[model samples]
Target: MEIDDLTPAETRVWRAFATGTPVDFRATDDEDPSDGGAWGAERTVRAHVLRALLLDGPRAEGEVPALNLAGVRVTGVLELQYATVDHPLRLRHCHFEDVPRLYGARLREVNLSESVLPGLISHAVRVEGVLRLTRARFAGMVRLGGAEVTGSLYLESTRIQAPDTEGPVLQLNQAVLGADLWAPGLVARGEVRLDGARVAGTVNLTDAVLDRPGGTALKAETLAAESDVLLRDAEVLGRLELRGARIPGRLDLSHARLANPGGTALRASSCVIGELWLRQGPMVEGVLNLRRTQVDVLFLEPEVVPAWVQLNDLTYTSLIPHEPAERRLPMLEKGDSYLPFVYEQLTASYRRIGDDDAARSVQLAKQRRYRRTLPWYGRLWGHLQDVTVGYGFRPLRAGGWLLSLLAVGSAAYGLHHPPPLKPAESPDFNPVFYTLDLLLPVISFGQENAFAPEGGYQTLAYVLIITGWILATTVIAGLTRTVSRQ
Candidate 1:
């Protein structure tokens, strides 16, 4: 690939690109056969012009001189399909007549910053260096599916407009990025697909705005990121899907606004993350679903409220600092059956750190929520047992009941002096033995039945018998529950 071998047109392109001299051609003069957009519109450079100037030799290694084609208006599908470039392509401030076709191409770097194009189809393209599309405007779909970039994929301030709501504006499934995938200030009309993508650094989408109202704005299932997935101050008009995604760092949703009324706004089910920070400035109109997500920490700040927060099967190791029980409890008040399990999860999280007091409070909170789910009569019964015996969780309270009843019966026998009808030579008022005989329903100590009651003692005897039966039933039920637990 020497300069002497170039054609007349190729030499002209090389003179402008290689020598840093400006070249202008009539874009409307020749109609390229490979036009991918704007039907019948004439283009500037032919498909082979820029390709001949930018293509690097197959064996070319290490860094070569960068091809600076800034502000150039290239024509029909700047097709560089499988050509390997050893140097970076700096096409900043350029206006493409159609989409660039870099599919399966190997490049050192590709920078199209501040450029205007119909679309970009570069799937399976391998870039050894960065790919910059900063502030670039796309009128159609931008497909970079399965592309592998050794460096970052910078799309900051980029605006993509795809009229089709069903299709994605940007597709990057399984695209591996060694550095950050910077899309801050990006505005996409269709879905932004990052499913199965792996980013070694952060997926920085901070302040990005995505608008796809009836459907998903972002689909990022099975995405694995080593650093944070920052959506700070960003806004999404539809659902943000992150199902089965793995982020070792925080998924910071601080100051983010999500709107998808009656449907799930943010679905992060089965995701494994370090922490999920829903700060006070965040707001979600629809459900914030975290079903089966395994997060080590959940840092929920005050004033962050979603229409519904579905935390079913969510497992977290701890609550972050300043996220007290009172503050976090209201977030679980979605008025659903999952409320009890959310409290249970909080209890388990606290117990994992040996915070039994916090665990107990969570248990009490769980019981309170459980009571809310019951019918009126069931609630009454639950409240009775909670005050007296803590719903069989407190077995020792049953002992308290027995002791109090025994003491009261004994005092009644000692003070009233109920006349005994036994022929034995015993004291007329044996309060201790008589009370024990009355309390133990299954075993008779020959003290209760051997004596006949007199005056109001008959009514007292009936009360003791009924109390004994009730206490026996409660003790048996508690023991059964404890044994079943084991």
Candidate 2:
């Protein structure tokens, strides 16, 4: 391109690109035209002119090629679809009249920090270097789906208030990043999706404020991250879903406030996480669902326990803090529905930590919950077992019942002796031996069969026999269950 045909600002940018010199159009560092402040023709560069300099520019000898322009107004859409450019594109603190389209373009690096644009569409683009959009503000959708970044993707302190759309406002689905996704202090007014995205390093979103109520705020289902996904101190007003995710490092949500009342605040169902730390206490206003999820270590010490949870089939190897069964049992009680497997999982977790008493309590609670689903007669039987033996968890209660019944039987029989079954043939009858014979159905002292009781004494004898049989049967059933579990 001839320099004679170029505008003053365009000529300056073209000459600077050949030697990789940055062009700053602002008269002062405080001058920011990003708020729609008009810039004169001397501070404007046509997109076609910039494109020509990027694709067909004449470079100086031994000088690198770069389009580094600042505080300039970019006119028209800078379409670079399927184009291969080796230069770095830096348009910092600039204003764009239209969204730049880089669909399927291959570039070295791109930095649009501190700029204001309607949106950006770089779908399927490949960047060998980092892609930085720090402090940039967008008013429409930012699509980067299927993009592969060799270096990190930075969105630090950026504000994106996207127009209403069917898809997420910031779409990065299926994108693969070589390094971390550093987006601390991000403020997105719409949904941010990372579905199927794979990050080699961590995905940090600390202090972010995502406000897309009645919908998913950050949907990262099946997101595989090598390091941690930190959302510490974030405030997400919608659902923060991570279903089917595989995070080798921790998914820390400490001090975060998630609010999606009457809906799922956090849904991590079917995920396989290394460690999930919800400690230092997060406030979840809705249901926290972890159904079918498997985590190596789960640290759940929320500030306020969720009113409802879905923990069916969730398997965690370890639980943090090792609180007693009383504290943890409340979590199971808040389940959406009765899940026997959840109680068993807690029981096993307590047992692994060498808390036998806690394990027993969890098991007993499981039986009580299970009893609610039975018929009236079955529930009545369950109540008997619970009152007598604590559903087999409190085996010592059986001994107490036996001792009390024996005392009652002995006092009644000692008050009035029965006639001998055969005169002069039966041995001398003893009240203690006679009560023992009547109480133990299988074991006899030959006292009950050798004597005869009439009227009220006969009725007392019948009662003792029936009560003894019930106690014996319950004890045997309870013991069998306990042994099998062991």
TM-score of every model versus the real structure: 0.77, 0.93
Query: In model 1, where do residues sit more than 4 Å from their true spots?
Result: 1-13, 19-48, 56-65, 301-312, 322-344, 364-384, 394-419, 422-457, 472-486
For candidate 1, the lDDT comes to 0.78
Score each candidate by Cα lDDT: 0.78, 0.91
Compute the lDDT of residue 412 as modeled in candidate 1.
Answer: 85
lDDT of 1 by residue, 1-486 (tens): 576765554456565564445443334423232232342223234555667666642222342455565445566678888878776677766678778999999998788887788899999999998999998888889999999999999999999997953589899998999999999999998899999999999999999999888789999999999999999999998999999999999999988898888788999999999999887575678888998999998887657767578888888887765445676677777735645677878777777777766666666567767887789998986776665556556767878987898899888888876666766754455787798888889887667866777768788888888878777776676566446633
* Deviation (Å) of 165 in candidate 1: 5.4
Q: What TM-score number comes out for model 2? A: 0.93
Cα lDDT tens digits, model 2, 1-486, are: 788999988889988998999999888877665754488898899888888988999799999989999999999999899999999999999999999999999999999999999999999999999999999999899999999999999999999997676678899999999999999999999999999999999999999999899899999999999999999989999999999999989998888898999899999999999999786755689989999999999989835468898999999999987888988998998886789999999999999989999999999999999898899999999998888888889999989988888998889889999899897899898998898888888998989989999999999899889988988888888888889889
Evaluated against the true structure, the overall lDDT of model 2 is: 0.91
In the order shown, the candidates' Cα RMSDs to the true structure are 6.5, 2.3
